[model samples]
Structures are given as C-alpha cells and as structure tokens.
Target chain A: MGATPTAAVLDAGNLQQLLDILQKQNYQTVGPTVRDNAVVYEHIQSVEDLPRGWTDEQTNGRYRLTHGKGKKFFGYVHGPNSWKKFLYPPARQLYAADRMKHRFDVVAPEPSGIKPALIGVRACELAAIMVQDRVLMDGEYIDPEYKARRQNAVIVAVNCTRAGGTCFCASMNTGPRVQEGYDILLTEVVDSHGHYFTVETASEKGRAIAAQLATSPASEEQLAAARQAVDKAARQMGRTLDLTDLKDSLYRGFDSIHWEKVAGRCLTCGNCTMVCPTCFCVNVEDTTALTGEQAFRIRRWDSCFTVDFSYIHGGSIRATDYSRYRQWLLHKLAYWQDQFGVVGCVGCGRCITWCPVGIDITEEARAVKG
Target chain B: MASKKKPTLAVWKFASCDGCQLSLLDCEDELLAVADVVQIANFPEASRAVKRGPYDISLVEGSITTPHDAERIHKIRRMSKTLVVIGACATAGGIQALRNFTDVRRYVSAVYAHPEYIETLNKSTPIADHVFVDFELRGCPINKYHLIEVINAYLNGRKPNIPSYSVCMECKRKGNVCVMVATGVPCLGPVTQAGCGAICPSFNRGCYSCFGPKETPNTEALAGWLHALDQRPDEIVRAFRGFNAYAEPFRKQSEAYEK
Candidate 1:
C-alpha cells in the first residue's frame, strides 16, 4: 500500500496469465515473435507468441537467430522493426479531399482507437519511445496520431539478462535495466530456482494489472538475483560510446576528414535511419487523381540519405553522399542535443547490425571526434 | 468540366519486349481515370487511334536497336512536348544491350532464320542516347504505379515523385529482414533504385536491380561487401549485370569485376 514495493513474482505459468489479463482488459497485447528469421514486434494473442528459447547473434551488418541457453521469453534483442512502427507508423494517410461541384470536402480517416499493451520492450527501446515522445508529443505542435497512440499504450519493460553482439546500452545509460518510463518492469531470472520474472509495478495501471495476476511477493534473494543478471548484462556490453564532451567534440569536428573516409564505404541506403527507433523524418506526397475528383496527401518515412530528401528548387541541397551521410550522423549525435535535450541515438546498435555494409556508428563517432 | 480539351498522351515502342507497354494497359483501376485527363493519342498497343503529334506527354518504351529506330527516336523527340521514357529498355538499353559487349551479328544469325532480313545497329542503346528524354523511368517491366505517377506529375506540371535512393530504403520500410546481412545472400538492394516496392527482397530473394542504378549508387562499396560475403568475382559481375546491366553504374561495376 505504501508504494507497491517490488510487487510479486510471476513464474512461467503466471506469465501466460499476465497476457490473458491484458487481453481481457481490452488491451491489444503486442510482443516479440519470430518472423522472417528475426525476432520482430507483432500482435500476439497469448504468451506462446513470444520468442521462447530463441536468441540472436548480432554484429556489424549481421543478425542471425540462434538457440538460447534456456526457456526465456524475452531472449532476443531488437530486430529491424522498431517499436516506432507501432507508434509513428511507416505510412499514414494524412487526409484526403473529394472534389464536389464547386468546392472540395476534406475527409479524415477514422482514428484507430485500439489500446496496445506493449510487452517485452527492452530498456534501450524504452528510451527510444521516450525520445520519440520528445520529438512528436513534447514539441511545439504535437502529432495527434502519435499522441493518441502513446496515451492509450501500456509499456511493459523487460530487463536484459544477456547482451547482444551489437548492444551498447550500458554505455548509453539507457538500458540493460529499466530505470523509468515503464508501467511495469520485468526482470527474467533463470537458474536452479527455475524460470521466473520479478515484477515491479511503476504506475497505478500496472499495479491494477499486477493485482489481477496470480503472484506472490518476491523475496530479497529473488530481487538480488534479478539485479545480478542485469548487472552481468551491463558488464557484457558488445560496444560502447564515450559520452564525455561528446556533443562538444561532434560540434568541433564538423569538418572532420573521417566523414570522407566513412562516406567512401557508406551506401546511403537509408537503412540506418529506418531502423533507428527515434528517427522521425517524414516526406509528404500529394496526389490528385487523374479524374480530378479525388486527392490524397500521404506521409511516409523519409531519410536524409535519400537524394531528394534535401531537394530545393534547382537541385538537391545535399547532392553528394558524404554530405547526406554527414547530415544523418551529425543530426543523430550532435544536432539532436541542440534540438531535443537528449542525444538522438539510444545506442541499441541497430544501425550497425542492419547496415548492409556494417557501418558502425560508434566507430564513426570515435573516428570523427578523434 | 467538358469544355477544356484534354492534353494528348502517346505511348511509343521500339527495339524490345512489349512488357512496358502492357504496364499501361495493366493499370485497370487507374486506366479509366487516366483516360479522363489525357486523350490516348497514339498507343498502338492499346488502341489503333493515332492522333497527330506534337503530343502533350509521350511515354516511350524500348531501346534503339536498329538504324531506323535511331532515326525514329529523334522524330519522336521532335514531336513530343514532354518525352518520358518508361522502362529499362528505354532508359538503360534493357537486357538486349548485352549485345554491346558481344557481336550482334552472331545474335542475329543465331535467332533469325535469315540474318540478312534483320536490319539492326551494332549497339542496342537507350532512347536517351538517340533523343532528348524529359524523364526516364527505370524498371525492367515498369511498376504501373510509377507509370501512373509519371503521367500524373506531367499533367499537373510537377516533377515526378520517383525516388532515386537505394531499394534498401523501401525494403527497410516494408519491415523485411535484410536478405544480404541476415541470410548472407548477396543483394543489390543497396545499389539498386527504389521501385517495384523492393519486391525481390520482400520475397526473400536479393534484388536483381531491375529498377536500374540508383542516383549516385556506391557500386564500388557494395561490390566490396558482396566480395566479403564470399561472392565470386563472376557472381559479383553477374549481380550488377542483370536487367539494368547497361546502366552506367552497373556497367562500370560489372566491368570492374570482369576478369
């Protein structure tokens, strides 16, 4: 009653019941599932939908699903599909207009009011959702769609028990443990004690859901074991970025010669931007039907890597690949601090893993700031 | 609505398959809507109705593979107010441009019953090589949506919103796992232009680059990754030398790997 202290323990069976409770509460539960040889976020009806006994091996330009040591639900790291797909969406119709006899009547698509209970969200991904909140919801003009979706969402954070090959959240100070921005935080601990999750409710909504689930108060040992697992993952970080004077270094290294070197190998494919959970750049296209009867304005994801993303009247502002690549890197690392109060990158290492050529952002930051 | 005369649109073809021309006919949903805005002036494939040019918008398909086509492309250019070339055949010389690397006489003799009957040029070249093309839509069999976009853009007096970025952008947007990175498959999505909605990658296959070379495609870097993936030099060459083989970036890259 005081603060709902480290509420309860949910074993493997209780975990499945937790999913059922969320579903019964009219929350469309979405979690990680194996698809296309990767662990991706998708709509799940039950706990069976979670990627159990499967993990991933990630490195620069490489991601492969591998067998995990035990039956762990949140075993794998993030895939190409980020949580942004749920909140921001890859493509959305802004509005449409139908030409009448003399005037045009604008029509807005019916708002999808379904509540989403985001389960198994990683610590770094929680940071990404907050980063997007700053960009979209906490801006001069809030995005109505993102605002509605975020408001209706229940975030369930999962503390990492293992580190992926591309993980650097420990250095980013965003993950390996869920510090904040979650309704419910779960730490999966597996050993001779058997597989179980130590649940910590952070909000009233989370506490209400926890009360419905069949659970018992976690012991001091269980709490310590969960902490040790997260601590182990923190120590096993696959990569790291120095945050000391990082923004200042990036600003001073504006004309760094390393840009040219990285650009030589960069494909400008926009994969890094697309896979980044916080990137919110979008391009709008307005099209009038050849019949001149109907018109639509659609907004789709855009990246600075595209030649036309920086286009002006005469030609593209960022004509060369080096300039475009520089724009993306500087925006994510340096300018994002100036714009938003935080660095754009959450250090999930997705950019490194998904890149066809394996362009490491951490390595580039080091090279540029050298 | 009735008084204003609709601008005339023409579809022309030359030295390749009629696949691109079929794309216009395949726009079943938008075909009627398109007809409402533009008069089908001279689409021999769809209609025998031949209105005289200078046409308002000309969607030219295929390449210049004959002495006659080389001269005829110039005539089409002079007649077309806005010449938009619509497929790999019109923009990158198509697969038939493989003849540019070999003897066309051998091909003519191999395919034709009478070699003397075929009057062809030594090189199979894009329409742009022979005429002034206002815009070039690159694809093996053109994406019908892009064809519609090109027509709509021309009619509305705006630049066509065709992206010249790598197909990886589209593939990533579709939320597909990277075939090259994830599965160790050699994909050209990193170098190919965005069109066909990243079809090949979505199907779990590497891009064959039917959309041609993207704007400023870093083929050299892509080739390096392809090589590191254990792709042999010949395989790497073949990867670049697919449907868009004659495109400058693909051509140069393929030539670089050719022994």
Candidate 2:
C-alpha cells in the first residue's frame, strides 16, 4: 500500500513524537512505570512516564530497581503486570439485568472505548500474548471481549538489551530479540556515538506511524551495535529450562518426590498464576442487589492453586498441595503442549521473582526430570 | 408477595469488642435495603426493640469466654434456623484465645482485685466448638460486603462466594508489588486468608493475618522465609499469635515455633 516497511533510526529525543502520534490515533499508551517499588504497566500519556535509567535486579523471590548512569527508556525487563491486564482484565462485568413486569431486561456491558497502544513489549511477553491469542481467540469457544480488545490494541515491542537475574527468555526461544508478532519493533542502543532507537516497521500501520516521525535510514554500524546488544542479553540469561523432552519428563514425573517437597514449601497462594502472563483461568459469579431488583454477572481471574479451582460436587479433586503443584507444573510444561500444540511457559521468570518462597520453576523442572 | 413474611435476623454478642456488630451498622446505605429484605428483629447495636428467639438468621459475634455464654450458645443454636458466626471472635476465639496457651487464673488474679468474683472459663472457644454453626465468616471484624454476601447467599439458598485463597491473590488483583519479595519484610499474606482485600500490603505494609490462615496455608514454609528475613523464631511465633491465635493452622505453627 505504501513504501515497503524498512529499518530506520530515530533519536531518543524524538521518541515522545511516537507517543503523541499514537494518542492522535486515539490509542491510550500503556507501558512500564515504577509503582509500589516495582515497575508495573499502567496508562501513560508521555514518554516521560516510561521507566528511564532504571534496570531491575530480579532473582528468585526478589526484585529491586537499580538506577544506572545512562538514560535507557526500556532498560528493565518486564514486571508483574503484563499486556494481558489490558486485554483479559482481572475482573469485568459480563452482563447486568433488571426485573421489569415478570420479564427481566438484560443489559450487555458497553463496548470498551480504550484502545491501548502497548509500549515496551518484550519478545517473551509477545510470545505470551500469542499463546493467549491461541487459547482465547483460536479456540472453538472464542472470547469475544478478548478478541475485540486484542484487535483494537497496537503493539510496540522492544528487544531486550539486558536480562534480569530471573530471566530465561533465551532458553524459551522467545526473547532477547524481537522475532515476529509485532507491528513495530525497537532495539534500544546507547553507545559512545549517541542514544537512539533502531526501529523496524513490520506492518503498513507501523510504517504509516513511522512516516510521521523524524527518522533516517539506520546506519550499518548502528544496526550491528543493536544486534550485539541483543546477543549480549541472550548470553546473560541468568536461568534456563532445558526443553529437551521437557513435556515427556513432566508427564512421567507425576509421582516424583519433588512434588511433595515443593508442596511442603508451597503456600498454594496462587501468586505464580496471577503474575504469569499466560495463566488464563477465571471464575464467574453472579450478584444480586439487596433490593433484588437488579443482578450482575462478573468474571474474575482464578488460579489452579486455589482449593476451589478444582472443586467438584463432593470436594476438590486436587485436595493435596502435592497434586495441585504437580498439576500446575505438568500443565505448564506437559499437558499444555498436548492441548494447544505449544509449551505454556514463556520463561519470563515472573513466577520465580514473585514467589514469596522462592520456588524456581527451572530448578523444579530439573528435579522432576530426575 | 405481601403474604411472604420477611426473614427475622438476630444479632448476638459474647465476650469481645463489638467491632463486628459495628460492621453491620457500618453498612449505612445498604442497611436500608437490607431492612427491606429481612426484619431486623433483635439487633441491640441498631435498635432498642427486641423480638423473641427462634430467629431465621442468628448473627453471632464474639467468643465463649465464660460458662454462662457457653451454655447460652447451645440455646441460641437450638433456636436459630441458620447460625452464622461473624468475625475472629465467633469463628476462632479472637485474641483472647491466647489464654488457651496459658493458665487463665494467673491473669485473673493479677488483674482483678478479687479472683473469686471473676467467673470465667480457662479456655476461650469459638461458637463452632460449643454449638453447630452453619457458617463461620473469618476476619478480625468481618468485611461488611462479605457479611452481606453471606446473607444474600443464605437467602438465595446458595453457597457464599467467599474465597478461602491467600491474601496474595487479592494483592496481585490490586496490582500491588509484593512487600516481602521487594523488601526483606516479613509478611503473613502468603499464609493468611483473602477476605481483608490485602489492605496492609496495599498501604506498603505486611499483612497482619486478620483474616486468619487460608486453606492449606503452609505456615512452616512461611516461617522459614521469615527466619531468613531476620525474624527470630519467637518473633515468628508472636506473628502467628495475633487476632487469630487459636485458629488451628496458626496455633499449631506458633506452637511449633515456640520451642
């Protein structure tokens, strides 16, 4: 439709123009912002809202933001909140109804007006989004709300130049560099020459937005530097989950003693599932006004670690913590592939960093494989 | 519809603070709507008017700390169609259950001028221990919305949609950064129940376990982390021995750490 999408270089100072253009297109920009001592995704109006000169130190059961010398916009890795919060929200009202002369009138929720421009999306997070797209959109029972929000949203993916201590995106083959599934991809480069972003337009929409910005053809040297930064990140991966027969090992490791040991330490708090980018379980509930005149149906995110998550007619199927932990680990590594034709985990390491007891999934997988 | 008699509700109290009953009164706007659905037959906190026993719903707040109240609960249980114990006092014996771990007479002799005059039981106990409780709503002072939810569920003949999951779930849902993970703070959120909506962590403080131990809470595991965070074993013991001290999981965990 237009000049073929090409790689270009935009100075760091001009990045704010991209935000303005996205806003002009009526897309609310949501990106990483430091909140409650950790970086979290929320609505942002300006590029200043992005975490600058800050990198995160994340290990099992720990996370802290460390401000550095240089001003790197997407300096840190992804945090607890993911792009799913903008798409598959934590809680939402499905419908409302009111009694009217023996017949109840149903009221559907108003269509969402906020079309989010998700900024600073990492490769692993993009992979997580793709995994969720397969689960929510490509399934027989389509989630209409997810489908609508996803179609409306725009992605601005950022290739990782530095990996957190808990990150293993390299092992997952999902990150360190943006491979695919992005409208616009950016690789941050801060070198002796200057600070800038090597941008690559993957779609016509991305090219149209880039055409509005002040950009030049990225030099061969700048592109190489960007590539080197990503390669450095790949080598700096702090953890790794060996994928060789990972699903088969998990399937056969059902009764392993490791499950019991993990269960003993596991609080069954559901923190892992909540922080996970791809955990898409939810429970629906109905509430009536005390007057009994109105009723509402709401859905909130649920986790398998909860006792009620596996509740049946008599009692919960996964009554023991051992079984529950085993089920979650197996499902993430084993059953997910059987059902969806892809592994569930994206190796973003949110589960490891957010876990209060420091349960490393990689270590658990290795122990299970034994 | 006029032929349908509204369900009669009775609010009763025992030896404890009336904060849980105050929670019902705190439902200022919703109280009017609640009144329309059910008859506020005998709530001493709200009105002077008292109705006869055999109430449709008996909301019990507080714990049995004396022989008189212990006997009184059985009678109330016989009269109530559905007896729901509200708050930590009625559900887990409240903070007064600390006396359960030690002799009650020494404290009585120390506080009261005349020990003979004080009539009390050695062990404070929850209503469930003395009588059959239909439901036990957990919290130091029960969440009013949850109280309303329990009432509504009872009226609709459905199970109450109260979550027994950990407070971490609520903290995550609120998009809160983990205080324990980020800082080396000792938090009870991982082992504590979710009813309080993680108010403490949202305020950048650790949870106080006001909602008690969640379903399948691994207190041993949490204690180990607390120890690693520089909390002494006694401090960990004291952490579990709070408002919900007598709750089975907390009691056992505190006892284990006591040594």
Candidate 3:
C-alpha cells in the first residue's frame, strides 16, 4: 500500500475470462488442481482442470477435502505443493560427459526455456519465493537455470478466504489476503445465493491483461464481498501461535525437558521438511553404473530428523532425537530472528498439516515457552 | 602399462545408515566430473572399480562401532591423504548414539541373532577419534552444496566457507518464522550448526540439533526455557544427549540433568 500500487478487481467470471486471455497471450496458465490426494499447483490449458467443486476442512495441523458448495476456481489453502517444484525443479541435470579415447570433455547443461503463469499464488508462498530469489538469483553465484525460470514467470495472487487449520498467517502477518508481489489478486465470494470471484490487478502486466480482456471495474459491493471473504478466512484459522517473549525462552531453554518429550514421539521421519514449501535442505549424490562407463550427479531432499543429517568428522554434534528436535525448533524460532532480521516462516502451515505424527508447532512452542 | 595419474577418491563405510556417503554420490551433476578429476578408488556402493586406497581423498561414512572399525580407520588414515567423515554415524555415532545411555551389550543380546559372535564397544565413536581428519563437514547428512564447497575448497587450497554458527543463522537468512518464539515450539536451533540451512524451521518446525552444537552456543539459557515449559529434568538431560552426545557441550548438558 505504501510504494506498491493499490488493489484492483475483476468480476466473478473474470477467472475463466482471465484464462482465455492468457491462452490468447501465449502464457501457460498454472494454478491449484486436485492431484494425488492433496491439492497441488499444476498447468491448466482450460477452466475444466480447475478443482471446480472442492473445498478443504482444516484443524490444528490437519486438513481434508470437504464438498464444494458450488463451482469455484480458487478455494483452498497453500497445498501440499507450492510454486517451488516448477521454479526450482527437484532434480536437474547439471552436465553430461563422454569418455572418448582416454580423453574427456564435460558439457554444461543447456537452459530449457519454460515460461509459466502462476495463478492462485498465496501471500506466504510469494514471500517464500522472494526468499529463494534472494538466495538463488541475487547472490553472486546465481543459478542460471533458476534465473531463467523465475524471470519468465507471471504472478496471480489469491486473497485467502479460507485459512487452513494449521495456518497462522495472521500471527506471521503473511496472509489471509494477498498483500503484494503479484500481477493480479482475487477474492472469491460465495454465499447462500451464488458465487463470484472479485479480481484485482496490481502490476503493469496485470493491467494489460485486464485491459485486453472484457471486464468491469470491481463494484463497491464486490469489494465488500472480497473483504468479507478474506475476513471469514482469517477467522477460520484452526490454530494460533503465540510469539510473545519467544527470543528469551529460546535463548534460556538450552537444556529443556520438553525436547525429550518431543524426541520420544518424533519418528525423525523428515516428512515435515519434504512436504514443506520452504524447506530447502538437499543432499547430493553421484549415480554411477558397474562399468564406471557413465555417471550423473544428483541432489535430493534431506532432513535433520535422520541421525545422518548432522554428522561431523569427529562425530555428529547432536546425537539424540532430543537435541536434534531442539536444534530444529530453536533455529526456527529464536536463532532465525537473531540472524536474518526476519522471522523464518510465513505461517503457511504446510509443515503442521503434513507431519505424519501430527505434531503441532503451537504445542511445542508452548512447551518450550511456558 | 599406462601410468596411474588420477587422484583416487575412495568412499568408505562405518556404522552409519549410508546416507552421508550417499550424499557424495547424490551429487548427480558433479559425480562424473568429480570422477573424471579423481579415480574411483574403493566405493562398494557405486561401482566394482575398487582400486585400493593410498587415495587422494577418502570420504568415510558411518561410525566406529567395533574394534575392527577402530583398527581399520587407522589403516584408512595411512592409505588416505585426506579423510573426510560423512553423516551422523561417522561424525558422532549416529542414532545408535542413543545406545550410549543404556547398556550396549544387553541391547545387542536383546535384539541381535547372536550376541556371542557380535563384538562391539561400550561406546560408538567417530572416525576422527580413530584418525586425523583433513576436514569434518557437518550435517545429519551433509548438505550437498556444502559438500561441494568443501571439495572445491580442498581443490583451491583454502578453508571451506562452512559456517560454525548455529541453525539460527540459516533460519534468519531464509526468513523462516521462528518455530520457538513465534509458535512457542521447542527447538535446538540455538546450539546446532548451520550446514542444514535451517530446514526444519523452513517447514515451520523447530530445529533439532541435527548439525550439533555451535561455537560457544548459549544452550544453558534455552534449556532453562524448556524446563519452564513443565518438562522434567531427566528429559532435559536427554535433550543434550542426542546424535552428538559424545560431543562436548551437549554431553555436559545432558550429564547435568543426571546430577
């Protein structure tokens, strides 16, 4: 609202119309659709691919699909997947090599040009993307592949009308509404009567799309609906995290008993990180065959839960689950604040919802802080 | 016969889950390039090309659980110019470090096929305990980027830009919400090092001490906070006695609970 431009909205039918315009403009329309068991963001050439009649019921660290009241394009929280898988592909071929006559020359992998238009981008995810952008793009050692993918992207944000059970965006001040970092923002309004989505454009690209497509200036009534919908979503959050006096507890509670309680229960399965949109730790591997004729290096997701995640030459510094669990929480809450000048999470709640043990961050925070 | 010119990179095994050494192979993009630069000396997991060591860089995985491993590491040190320990087990005895608290012999007899044939130590120690290390890269399984950095550093004749600071540094850099203060979640971020890039918090979970204690980490204060959360002192002691329990600060902290 300060230096960023004001919000704008298109009518309910603007979603389908927006798709038509993007298709015509030669942009790949990508948004949330039901894939696997949970909702995930994927490419859609038409409106048919959208999860037209799907909604979610969320609780503290739990989420499940409930029947949709009506046909709606966007009606979900941050899904099991985020924009990361496309922007930063899980596995990438860095280079290829061939051995000829006892002499070898390795060729760097070429960039694959893939421009994606990301619709239904959430506030928190956008923030996460920015964080990644800072790491991958802004740094001196830029990832050429990531740079190519991210620069060719279009952003369509959705004002959250339904916060998930594990959501604490209000506490983190990252969501329940699309604040910024998008070309367009939409708020879906559904009542006893019918359903319509109010869309707002925020960027130059967004304005061009709205101008090209036939659309009305969002009415005051439609604006009220958008506001009301976002309010409902904010109020619907299933859990809340208390950040008060957090730094002191993290600093003071080095040998807390709560860690043992958590460790006893934690499978250290690392599921929480794998499913998390922001969890970016990766382990490197080199795959080779029996003949040693060929090979390719790869990177896979790794987690701290595994005893192997924290090994050192002399030995692992944190040997038990209690210390491992403690390290994870303390870094997330206390140390992140100290180092980054920013809190480490946007309260998307993916980790809470996806954890196999259903361990709640809120519960652990209280245990350590109380 | 053609003269052997390539520097041999031998990956070894110890008492770990094989995840750490796998981290080296996980460098899918860099593997062949690294192989081209160095010979595949002795890696049982990847290839049959088991050239005997006297290797340039010996990447050892797992921990020293048996007398055989203890003796073998000495041989490896002799055969290797650079011995780099990979993963939790090799670095700090691994989850098997959990056995450090209870009786190893009794647990062995209770779980194994034949305790009579199984010869093991009362404590599981790291590779460094048995041999002099060129470098000790940290992680539950070391981050591939950091691993590459270390390799690159060795090649360039410099200290790897590995941070000794805790996971808190990474969480801050990633802009993750602090799981502890913001969510009141308990975490070990204050003590554990930064190789993990603050992953648990990125997912909205707390830091576990997967990377082990940082330099002069003020864990005592954080431990007091966990105690105030209504946890018992025994549990507090167990918190410190984790994957790197044999390591100093965590060992001392864990022992304090017993006292």
Candidate 4:
C-alpha cells in the first residue's frame, strides 16, 4: 500500500542512511558505476559505488558520458551490459553431472548471492525488465536460472526527468516515467532551488525498505512536484511513433516496396537485436570434448539478421537480403505483437543508437508506413 | 507370440540450433511416449545414451556447409529409412548462405580466430544439394506442429499436408489486412511461402521471408514494387539475398541487384 509518499534528498550525509537501510535488510545493493568509461551495472557498498556527477548523451551511433551538474544517482539510458547479463548470464553451465552407482544424476547450479536492490533505474530500463519478463519468465519454457535471479531480486524504478535526443521510449510506449513493475519508483527533480526526489513504494518489499529508511511522510505538495517533473520530461521526449493499427499497417504492406529501400542501408550486423532486451531467440551448440565422454551443450544469443539464423537443408529459403531484411522488420514490428500482444520494441532506442550505420528503426517505420 | 516392434526414431543435427530437436523434448507430455514409440536411437542434444543408428527415421537439422558434412549426409542417407530435413538451415542452408554472396574465405577469417583451424565449403549448402532428402521442412526455425506432421506422415505412410501457397493466402484466411497495399508497409508475403501463418505483416512490420519463396515466385515483380517504395536497387538485392539467399529464385533476384 502506497500510503503517504516519501520525499528525501540523500545529500552526502543521507548517503550513509541509504546504505544502512539496504545493509539492515540484508539485500545486496546494485547500481551504476564508471566501468571502461561507460556506466556499467555492478555491486555497490556505499555512495562511492554510485556513478556520481555522470550523465549520458545518446543518439544513433553515438553514446557519450558527460560531467553531471552535481551529485546524481542514476543517469544513463543503458549500457553494453544489462541486468540480463547478471540474471541469465552470457554463458552459464546449466547443470553438472555426477555418475552414481548406476546412472547419471543432474545437479543444478546454486543461486549466486546477487539479491540486488537496483538503485536509480530509469523508467525505460524498468520497461525493459518487463519485456524480458514476458520472454524469459512468462514463456512456456522458463529459463531456470532467470527464474532464480528474478525471484530473489528487488527493483527500484526512477522516472526520467531528462531525455537525451536518442531516446524513443514514448514512441515505444515504454517510458519517460516508470510504471507498475518496479518495487519502488523514484523521480528526480532538479531546478535552481535544489535537487531532490519523490519516492513511492509499489510492492511490499519496497514498503519494508521505506520503513527501514529515515524518511518522513511526504506532503501532497511534494507529490504534485513529482507529477509536474514527470510531465516536463514527457514533453521533452526525443521521439514519437504512430503505433495505431501498426500490425494491420504491415499486414497490408507486404509488397509495399519499402523493404527494398531499407535493405539498401541495413548491414545485417545484428547490433540491434544483440542489445535488444526482449529478443530471446538463441542458438544452441553441442560441443564434444577430446575424450568424447565430456560433452556439453550451450546456448548463445542469435539474430535473424545473421545468415545462419535461417539456414535450410537445401540452402536458405529467404535466399536474398531483401527477404532476410523483411523478416527482421516483420518480426520486430508485426509478428512480435501478433505473438505477444505487446509490440516487440520498448523504445529504449538502443537499436538505433548502437547501429553502426545509424539506421533508425523509427525512420524506417515511417518510410514504410507512409 | 510375436513381440510388438517399436518404430526406431533418431534426431540428428548438422549446422543449426538444437531448438528443433529440443522441440521434441519441449513436448514434455509427448516425450516419454515418443521415446516409447521410437527406440530413441540418437539425439545428442537430449540424452547421451546413444543407441547405434541405421535408424528407421532420421529427423535432420542444419545444413551441409563443408566437404565433410557433404560426405556425411550420404552415409546418413544410406542409414536412414526416411530422412526429413528440419528447419531452414537443413532445407535452405540457413542464414549461413549469406556467405554464398561473398568469399567464404573472407567470412571464415572475419569470424574465426584462426582460419586454418576452420573447415568450410565455398558455399553453405542444404541437405538436398548433396543427397535425396525424403522431405524438407521450412522456416528459420521450423514449426513444431509441422515437425510432428512430417513425423506422423512417415510413421503412417502419407504425404505431409503442407501448403505451398504464398503468405498472402494465410493472411486472407486469417482476416488480416494486406500490409503492402493498405499501409504501404513493405512486406514479402506476395512471393514468399505460406508458412509462419503470415504473422509478421499482420502486425506493423514488413515480412522478412523466413519460409523462403514459393513455387515459381514472381520475385521480379516483387522487386519492382520494392523499388517503388523508395528502396535502392542494392537494398532490394540485399533483401532477397539474405537468410534464404541461396534459394534459386531469391538468389537470382538478389544477384540481379548486386552492387
């Protein structure tokens, strides 16, 4: 129950209070810190573990970190590293075998002590977690490792009061503000007056954390301030896309001649899908060791753009760049919604921002849809 | 009294994801019964318990991309009573056929640590290129239900009821709008095969042909329409030369637009 909201500014002194609250609850704190010049998600002990005075500028084929105005908790869109890396790990040994007296028994790996209380998570990133949830947790075949990691974790979502030029969460219907999936949601508001946050609890775990913290009841005025700040961020959003009847739009455009145009620029490098939070298609490899007795199976992320992703017995069926390019567009915009009811894109703009050639999906969609 | 003979079933892999075989395991309820019906002769992905082949039916995944693989398919053809190539990889050489456009040497060097350690053909070919395949299942990832259909057809001696029509037929059947004509979304449903139930264009995106081209595809006409949508000739060629780039009609069309 989100009774009275809480208002607090952890100005240097309150930094210790934040750590003590997390330590008291015995939840491992995870937040952003400078790793290889990029804000990477990792474990945190205190305020020093946070990415202080660091912000990000994102656009197609460009991502740069800027010196923040002052002390800030979380200020990044996303990085090469995602929560999925820690949750579903890039390469994980699923099970180990120990031959008994008669047959072999499977032993599952124990959970890594990563009960992370994610601090300063942006709304778009939180939406990403939900999209991944539909793929990993909600699917008929649940990833056992992902289940363990997600079940033990706590999510703290924050509304983005600032949107750089590359963001398109509004178009993707993902965010400018955080929504229901988070356990706790915070909105950052900075002005000439001061920098502060308006925090709300979504889940019971969030409520428990609030109880442990040295926070007082928030006034209605502070709550209004959070709403106004969120609205301002919404107005300043970087991009917008007309998603109405998009599925039907693609359905009728099968031979619309737009794909050939797109195929010209699409390099098929797969950077888009690699960074995409919900693209769950994977390729499995079965490797046999020298002894033959030692063999193991592994799963790795695979993209439809890759030629090998669509191989056939005789050869590839979609044997042309046009077809493969169309397949990805269709899958991302059309078939994804058909299968999952929700559009595949979360509008984090990682695909556009990370694409080597700066092939903007929004621009592509507009060209084809028009 | 004569003992009831169980049908011997084997799952095989070539150059693809183990998903299709995993589909058998995914059928948790049917798996034990599947194991019971078939001797479960071979399936490296699931169980290590290898019962030697000469299998009654071999469901092969992936494609022939090397000299060794080409030779191996022949041995498999000899051993298997009924051979079914599953997934796009097995039927169309998968997405690896993208290498068919460029030098395989360059590709191997680009992807591998040591080109000397890697062994590959000039082109990634399909199971049908080297040997007679009993049946070829389509899709970047083959449809599991259709997979069961192929298996059932072999078990009972019937032709698989797979439609060879365009995706447009399915879209019309499902009451979906014509994406290309209606919304101007460039899709590939017109000439592409009718598998995947016309799922992509039904949404807001274009159809990337995963099921490959249909019988006597009018790829030339399709390319013309694509050009009208402001696509450059090279892009149009690249589109057709992608996942199923080695397939004849698409391959020819892609080459027609080559830079």
Winning model by TM-score: 2
lDDT of 2 by residue, B1-259 (tens): 2357889999999977999989888998888778878899999889999999789999999999998998899889999999999999888999999999999999999999999999999998999999889999999888999999988887766778899999999899888889999877789999999999899999889999999999999999999889988899999999999999999999999999898
Q: List model 4 lDDT by residue over A1-370, tens digit each.
A: 2443455432333545766787677877777777645566777788787777787776665566677776666555565445655566555666555545577566666766566677767777777777777778898878876777787778877787667666788777778877678887776655444566666787788877766665555556666777887777678776776798788887777787888877766545455666666677766644332222333455656567655567668766666666776787778788988777678777777677655445788887777777
Ranking by DockQ: 2, 1, 3, 4
- State the lDDT of candidate 1 residue by residue for A267-307, as single tens digits: 99899999999999999988877665788899999999998
Tens-digit per-residue lDDT, A123-185, candidate 3: 888877776676678767787888898887788777887777688888777777777778877
Model 1 lDDT, residue A26, Cα: 93
Q: What is the DockQ score of candidate 1, to 2 decimals?
A: 0.75
Global local distance difference test of model 4: 0.70
Docking class of 1: medium
In angstroms, the error of model 4 at A245 is 1.2
TM-score of chain A, all candidates: 0.97, 0.97, 0.89, 0.88
Candidate 1 chain B: worst 10 consecutive residues by lDDT? Answer: B152-161
Per-model TM-score on C-alpha atoms: 0.97, 0.98, 0.59, 0.57
> Taking the candidates in order, what DockQ does each have?
0.75, 0.78, 0.04, 0.02
1 versus 2: better TM-score goes to: 2
lDDT of 2 by residue, A26-111 (tens): 99899999887888999998988989987888988988878888699998887788889899999999999998988999998875
Best model per lDDT = 2
Clashes in predicted model 4: 66
Q: What would the DockQ be for model 4?
A: 0.02
Where model 1 places Cα greater than 4 Å from the true spot, the runs are A1-4, A100-105, B109-114
- What order do candidates take by lDDT, descending? 2, 1, 3, 4
Question: How well does candidate 2 score on lDDT at residue B67?
Answer: 89
lDDT of each: 0.88, 0.90, 0.71, 0.70
Interface RMSD of each: 1.2, 1.2, 12.5, 17.2
Candidate 2: which stretches are off by over 4 Å? A1-5, A100-105, B1-3
